[model samples]
Target chain A: MYVAAKGGEKAIRNAHALLAKRRRGNKNLPSISLAQIAQQLTLAVDRVMAEGSLYDVELAALAVKQARGDLIEAIFLIRAFRTTLPRFGYAQALDTSEMLVRRRVSATYKDLPGGQLLGPTFDYTHRLLDTSLGVADEAGEVDDEARQADPADAAPVAMPRVTDLLGQEGLIEAAPADEGAEPFDITRAPVSFPVDRSTRLQTLARGDEGYLLALGYSTQRGYARSHPFVGEIRFGDVEVIFEAPELGFELSLGTVQVTECQSVNQFKGSATTPPQFTRGYGLVFGQCERKALSMALVERALRWKELGEEPGAPAQDEEFVLSHCDNVQATGFVEHLKLPHYVDFQAELDLVRRMRAEQAAERPADGIKEAAE
Target chain B: MALMARAEAGELEAVLAGFAPLPAASDLKPPEVGLVMLRGRTGGDGAPFNLGEATVSRAAVRLEGGASGFAYRLGRDVKAARAAAILDALWQDEARRAEVDAALAPVRARLAAEAAQVRAETAATKVDFFTLVRGED
Candidate 1:
């Protein structure tokens, strides 16, 4: 009797069991808790949240654990989970100005109204490994000097933005505000041609960090090269507001931590437009400042339309950049080719074979004679 | 007998009162409608093929003041077809529009609430990332 694939199900079950056992490793080793992962590996949680387009640290931590420390897998899990969600009311346009400034810095200015608060950045930290940290148990208390250095005690002040300073002196043209225009929903609606600024920014916010990094790097190396300066980069929590149907206006619902970047680019004078500095903006969820800044630079490069520049290069073309930007869609389309396609492939093979036979028949009799000789 | 009972109870009159009669219905015979082909797949497993067409009946009723309603269903059941035609007529009727809207109100409200709940659950898990050096052994 032919026993056809009797052990397939059993083999699959056994493999799954083995995988679970391997993932756990030696039981003696302390299992990593979700809280510990969230608190200790916060950057990974931040990346998962940023790319996954989810904000919950606990969920991100759980995803990291479930994915066996694979950040991409964690991101994929979050994205899949996000699709099941339905959109309620749109949040009121975020006011970045009112953000409780955590880390705010302007590369364009040496001194600003609100002095540069370094916050908790590792910009100047030495890359040396601290072996002593493994033995160190007791956490140190805040000294009197450190307490006095805290910027939180400072008065609530509305600092003039560095970009505004340039606009004040006519170094850069004022950004046109579209208060009436409704921003397109990138999640629900399919992204079509001639995308608006809001839709473009939304796509960039959830874009793959590595992909954007490579593209941004390419731009720096003279691929549609545009001289850019980090105008301002800020990371902090901003309140999300939404309009209730009963209430005519808007009200604050909750807050989300975001990284905002504004990149200033050098603009040459066009025939109709005068020479003035143009701006690129990137705002992403969580504390991914580097990714946000890279996104901002790429965004400015993509703004060939408003800049009155011809789309001769890849970066200058909006359709090219936006179409190929999403990693999820790209990965899905690429991997889908691996699915069973023997029938379609067989049809193509038959067509090619028939064509070759027809071509051979159509060839000269002399060619056949020469081959025979 | 049922038809006679309905006519005696003024049910047909009440249905007609809801909408202005269609210009085409002036003729004694009921209005003619066409079937829409229903496309479906065949084969238990492996590559599925389109399994031939099925006949469907469709009708449209236009009320006097420009409002219109449509009805469509598989197969030709005369009574069901007539009932559907009457429903279309009632839907187009300006007098019964408020009733139709009231009937749909609860369903629409439920759908909206479900959508809002889905959004809340999804938004609750949004995350952002920061760079960090991984611990080395």
Candidate 2:
């Protein structure tokens, strides 16, 4: 029922050539630089970096440019490139308590510590597109007063987390002990059903933002809902420390920008426990507040069993959520349909044709005679 | 080392040029680009988890005088890593340590200025809350 056929080697090469030309839309227009994409299209770079699970800004920018601004394609490129490199070390767990605070806000409390600094967020901005941005000359204009420049002393030198405040009062659940046990590495090992919190968190950290967003949104719509509140959302840079084999002691490996979200969810006390606030954690590379927030929501939803809540929703199903969360794998399987499945399709076609012919033969002159009688 | 890693694209090379006839560094470990898994604690302060991986380039080099040094940074800059490794080797010599510091002074200044700017910008957004009084007040 199946036969092998191969042809289209030259066609594939020519198709790639056409694609390269199409990527550069106009012949006379100036080509975009990697620096420009890294600087100007920063959020795009951040998204690709987050989803790609690779923290190199320059490479993400290059991938974006080469993919012609297709983020998933860019992510695929980064994922492919990541496999070629050897993993040298594991960094000491990031201590975000010492983050050089850029944007810090808490929805649970209004006048909390660090006093809610809004650093370059588009939260309050009207969604309308400014026509000026379309014009090259007008786009360069800067309004000084719009920035609301103030003295340096206004922001406190020591910014603390809102969760720490609630944590102090024993309102929120405490952090688990630092048991020197090694967390399961999602990349190194194949993920199986019913993973630990560490694996689930890692999977969600690099999971497709759009997929997580939808799943998170579903939780809010009462599918295993956990009344969630933004305990704190902060975007800033933290120094990475690594103790490489060559260097025995811990050494600073520069800083990486990250967005961290901690969600406080309402929990009903179980028979053995007292009612208290629970937490959902999310941390991702670069300043990806939206993705971080969505990750937090879904993270809380996924903890249904551990928290003693009934788990029937799709978000609550660890195997279902984790298995389909990775966009690269999802896209690959979905897009593979485009590839030549001639043998597979031909088998189905032949089966259908033979079945129809057999039915016609079986239907015989007796059927016509019976109908006439 | 932080200053060297944080320097601009060509700043390390520019600073290295100052010491024209520098001691050659032999590669103990040639510059290699690789990934370093960046781990994070749950709830921002809990049990550790693998958040993601960052691109890290590392190199180890030994000076002619037997001083070995290493460099690691969170990007794909092999040249920078090698230059930093060489600087590390040079700085191990107490006599040349001051020289390395003096060369990297500009980078220190630049980093300080950038931090101050971020501080000022972030400070501007800090909410200055005022309490609202009742009608009797």
TM-score of chain A of each: 0.84, 0.94
Write candidate 1's Cα lDDT for A1-373 as tens digits: 1122334678789988997787788999999999999888888898887777766677788889988898887888877865554333444455667766667788777566666666557777797766766677333333434333323335455756567788787777565554554456566578788876666766777788887887777778888677888888877766544443433554433355677777888878678767888777777767788788888878888887777766676766778777877777777787777655666777889999999888788886866887999
Tens digits of per-residue lDDT for model 2, A50-143: 9999999999999999999999999999999999999987899998999888889888888886678888799988988888777764755556
RMSD to the true structure for each prediction, in A, is: 19.2, 2.9
User: Ten consecutive residues with minimal summed lDDT in candidate 2 chain A?
Assistant: A147-156
Docking quality of model 1: it rates as incorrect
Supply candidate 1's per-residue lDDT for A321. 79
Q: Rate the local accuracy (lDDT) of all candidates.
A: 0.61, 0.87
Badly placed stretches (over 4 Å) of model 2 are: A1-5, A137-140, A143-151, A154-156, A361-373, B128-137
Per-candidate fnat, comma-separated = 0.00, 0.75
In candidate 1 the C-alpha lDDT for residue A168 amounts to 84
